[model samples]
Structures are given as C-alpha cells and as structure tokens.
Target: MDVLLERKSVRNYTNEDVKQEDLEYILRAAMSAPTARNTRCYSFLVIKNKETHKKIAQIHRAAQMILEAPLAILVVGDEDKAYEKYLPQDCAAATQNILLAATAKGYGSVWCGIYSNEERAKAIEKLFDLPTNIKAFSIVVIGKSTDNRPPKNGWDPEKTKYEKWK
Candidate 1:
C-alpha cells in the first residue's frame, strides 16, 4: 500500500540509467495486472534507441520527456487475442499498471497518450509498421528521478455516482 501511495508522475530525471533487472521486474509486475475476460492480449515495445525515442517525442508535442528519459515503453494491445472496441481501454489499463509499478520501484515515469487522436495513431502505426488491429495507445517514459514531490490522490468522488438509475 505504501508503494501505491508513493507512486507519482515524475518529469525531471537524474543521469543514472535504469537497471535492466529493475525494468524487467516492473514489466513483469505490469503483466501481472488482471485483464478483462483474461484477454491477456498485450504487447510491449521498449524504446531504448535514441533515434526511435526522439521520433516518438515528435508525435507528442508536450512530450519532451521522451528525449530525456532513458526508456519509453510502448504499450499495445494484441488484437490476435483481444476483441475490438475494448482493445484500447484494455491496453490503457495495462499501461497504467506499468506506470504505477515504476513509481513503486523509486523510478520516475510519465504516460504519453498516443491513441487519443487518429492522426497521432496513424503516425505511430506507420512509424512502427504495426498491423491494423494492434493499437499503440500509450507511451510510458521511465527513468531515475532528479526531483521528487508529494504523492497525489485522484479521488474524484463527485465525479462518480451510486445506484440512482434514472
């Protein structure tokens, strides 16, 4: 629980490179997250090449982190096992788990939304030459944090409603 609470979006990072073991452990934790109907239809693309990461940054205007962060995790849904329509949402959940796990490991992370717009999606797909069904919904930037802030809570109670079916 402490890990969950301590998790936060970190932008500024240190010069240290993320350990391969740490990266694998976090990815494993992310894969452990439950999926709808046990779809288990997810794929991950780790962008460590400077050139590739830079290209991803170009797709996201407010994503300068891609250039600084040592790693960019491209979370995609494998359509071969996933149903249509729910593909993106399922992939997003998996992506969130990765971000949270990275935070728990004392690493800084940020999520870049890539599937919010058709143009952006098309650009990413073409860049990677991904199939039609496999969708890149989110890109997570992970690295060692140079600065730390207090943990945040996103408990929007007013935004949620109970059983008052109208």
Candidate 2:
C-alpha cells in the first residue's frame, strides 16, 4: 500500500544508468500481471540506446523524459496473440506492474501513453520496425531519480459509488 501511494510519475532522472538485474526484475514483474485468458500477448521493447530514446522523445511530445532516462521500455500489444478487446486492458495492467516494481526497487519511472494516438503509434512502429500486428501501447522510462517527492494520496470519497449510483 505504501508503495502504491508512493508510485508517482518521475520525469527527472540522474545520469546513473539502471542496473541490468533491476531491469530484468521489472520485466519479470510486468510479465506476472494478469492477462485475459492467460494470453500474455505483450512484448517488451527495451530501449537503452541514447539515439533511440531521443527519437522516441521526439515522437511523443509528452515523453521528453525518455531522452533523459537511462532506459525506456515500450509495452507493445499483439492483436493476433491476444483478443483485440482485451489488448488495452492487458497492456495497461502490465505497465502498472512495471511501475510498481520499479518503485519498489527504488527506481524512478514514468508511463507515457502511446496507444490511443495513431501518429505516435506509427512513429513507434517505424522507429522500432515493429510488425503491423504489434502496436505500441505505452512507454515506461526508468532511471535514478534526480528529485525526491513525498507520496500522494488522492482518494476521493465523493468519487466512490456503492453498489448503485446515488
């Protein structure tokens, strides 16, 4: 619960690179996320190259953090491997898992959305030379944080609804 509350989007990062073992652990946590019909139809595209990160940052205006982060990961979804209806949900779950795992390991991370925007998606596909069947869902930038922020709890009682809307 503490980890969940502390999991905030970190945009600024230090020069230190993420550890290989930590990256592997984050990927493992992502794969552990629950998928519809047990169809883990997500592929992780790890971007460690500075040029690739720069290109990605250019592709997504809101993802400038990619350029500064030591590493970025694209959580891609395959329609042929998983049901199209469940692709977004499955990918989002995997993304959240990755963020939480990174936070638990004392790493900073950010989730940059890319699935809903056609231009962004195409750019990613072309940049990574991904197949037509695979689509980039989200980008997770990971690195050592340069800033420290306290946890945020945005629980709103007004937004909560019981069994039925009042």
Global lDDT for candidate 1? Answer: 0.82
* Candidate 2: residue pairs that collide: none
State the displacement of the C-alpha of residue 94, model 1, in Å, after optimal TM-score superposition.
Answer: 0.8
Model 2 TM-score is: 0.95
For 1-166, candidate 2 gives per-residue lDDT tens digits of 4678889899999878888999999999999998899889998988889988888878899999887888988999998989658999999999999999999889999999999999999998998899898989999999999767765678899999899996
Each prediction's whole-model lDDT (CA): 0.82, 0.91
Q: Write the per-residue lDDT of candidate 1 for residues 85-134, one digit (tens) a residue.
A: 67777888888899888887779898888877789888988899999878
Count of backbone collisions in candidate 1: 0
Off by over 4 Å in 2: none
User: Which candidate should be chosen as best, given TM-score against the real structure?
Assistant: 2
